[model samples]
Target chain A: MKHLVLGGVRSGKSQFAERWIAEQRKQIVYIATSQVWDGSMAERIAKHQSYRPDHWHTIEEPITLADTLKKVASEQPESGVIVECCSLWLTNLLCAENEAQLTQEREQFLAVLENYPLPVILVSAEVGLGIMPINALARRYGDEIGVLNQRMAQICDQVTLVTAGLPMTLKATQGK
Target chain B: MKHLVLGGVRSGKSQFAERWIAEQRKQIVYIATSQVWDGSMAERIAKHQSYRPDHWHTIEEPITLADTLKKVASEQPESGVIVECCSLWLTNLLCAENEAQLTQEREQFLAVLENYPLPVILVSAEVGLGIMPINALARRYGDEIGVLNQRMAQICDQVTLVTAGLPMTLKATQGK
Candidate 1:
């Protein structure tokens, strides 16, 4: 099953996705995309780490998400790999690489979503629901993230949008 | 019918609300909460005005929304009032007023929602689904908006969440 979970900041998307995937009873591979660049972010990361079972294999990969997924599949075919979020991964790529490089990475990631082997749950931020950002960087990030979510939703089997700590399934697999 | 329409930017909340109210065949009092403080904002306001029906009465009230609503109800109780958005109204209050003034204004607005005489439709932005803002002002705005939405949702007769141009009814009057 390929599931895409989306929400705003503190929308309980990560916790919801985690619980849903855990219910499947598969060995979990938690693919974290965040890098602790600041003190607050480090605290956030630590808080997230505390909730998950200590045995869940954790992989910290800010970029090269597609490559990491491929490697995980080969090593643990039966395990469900969770991509903690696409927004932070895109942020990393946006800041570190040029447009072409980011495009290449995004394309590769989408291509892999087409026929992913393992049960994969991709978490993403739904950031387009507010006012037009006053800053250029935030606007650019919103545009990229919105486009990525649409493309990912088209390919993924299921998509859930969380709001106010509630999960609403926007797209679901038919007859499953 | 009092309806609260919530969505992210470009999620079509305004259009959806406009269309819904237009279908009711009542005169609309478009209570805009934005003041054109800059060139970009002027453009945005102009663009919005262009799409709306020419005959619809428009009122630009950045603050004193509750007072304006009261006046509108008395002057044109038969007409439907559309508060263009709560987010902008809150933004106006956040910037111009002290905490005490803002609280009084917010309380008055909620008090009016309890039994709004005329058919009213309120629009708001659902902005909590994203990364924690990096700045203090943005963070404060997000927190305020989130709490406001929750309180508004509890009071409104109907709450519709718009996503990608579709409206999902989150709460609706029973037997309606």
Candidate 2:
């Protein structure tokens, strides 16, 4: 079983996932996808790092999420694999600029999930659920991430929405 | 074939790997394994993020190394899969506290390299080559990561030692 989380900014989605991952088992591995390009984002990244327990393994990946997930999953498919959110990942994928590469990378990431070996938990932002973006690229990103999430949800055994520090199960097939 | 990089702290190993990954004959996907927990690390992460070109795909994973690699290998196994550094990751795995889980994870991580789908590169610190540490845990980590790297070097197709921004191939094997 895998848990897919979606929510808005400051929606407590990451916190929910972190706390949950910490509790799942002793061998916790946190997969972070955020890149600290600015002071604000740097602060955000630091805060996320400080939250983890000392023993949890961490791999800093700004891209190649699907590949990294496969690596971890293949090694410990039964262990917890928590990727904070896929929204940023989708953004990264679409930002590849080359249309063919972007499409190819997208398919590759999806394939990683499709053949995922363990109980993987993923968190992503709910793009376009509230409002459509005015800018072309922003709108495209929103649409793209929404599509990515749907593609993932279609295959995920469980899906949950995190709002106001609350978790409402969306696709709960079998909660392990 | 994958190009391996081994070095000490602040030796520009990551920058070297980034450059190599960027100069690849295929699309680039960064598989990061660092998470932010403090102001210092956040700043470091931000600096790295800011330096990256806008077109590359980024995947944020603080953990789950083997699974991610396998997925990328399966998707683009022939291109390149350069995973930056295994020191921290080995530390993360050893911190599991559960011997069974630790051994399982270690075995799994090592096993993925045997018949991986892609040409892979691994960046790791030569921690043990330096002076022994004063602290017990620090020394343990140094020892553990050192052993991990040595074993990886044995299985890897090629190994390179990077010192003062120069790379010397220590071991080489033709990849299938």
Restricting to chain A, the TM-score for each candidate equals 0.97, 0.90
lDDT of each: 0.86, 0.69
Best lDDT among the predictions, by candidate number: 1
Cα RMSD for candidate 2?
A: 23.7
lDDT of 1 by residue, B66-154 (tens): 89999999998778889998999999899985899899999999998777888788999888965456787787788788767767777
TM-score of chain A of 1: 0.97
lDDT of 2 at B129: 29
Off by over 4 Å in 1: B1-125, B129-134, B143-167, B171-176
Interface RMSD for candidates 1 onward, in order: 3.7, 21.8
Instruction: Evaluate model 1: give its lDDT.
Output: 0.86
Docking class of 2: incorrect
User: Each model's RMSD to truth, in Å?
Assistant: 6.6, 23.7
Q: Model 2 segments beyond 4 Å from truth?
A: A76-78, B1-176
Model 1, docking class: incorrect
Writing each residue's lDDT as its tens digit, candidate 2 over A5-62 gives 8765544678778777666666777888777667856976887788777877888776
Candidate 1 at residue A132, lDDT?
54
Give the true-contact fraction for every prediction, in order: 0.26, 0.00
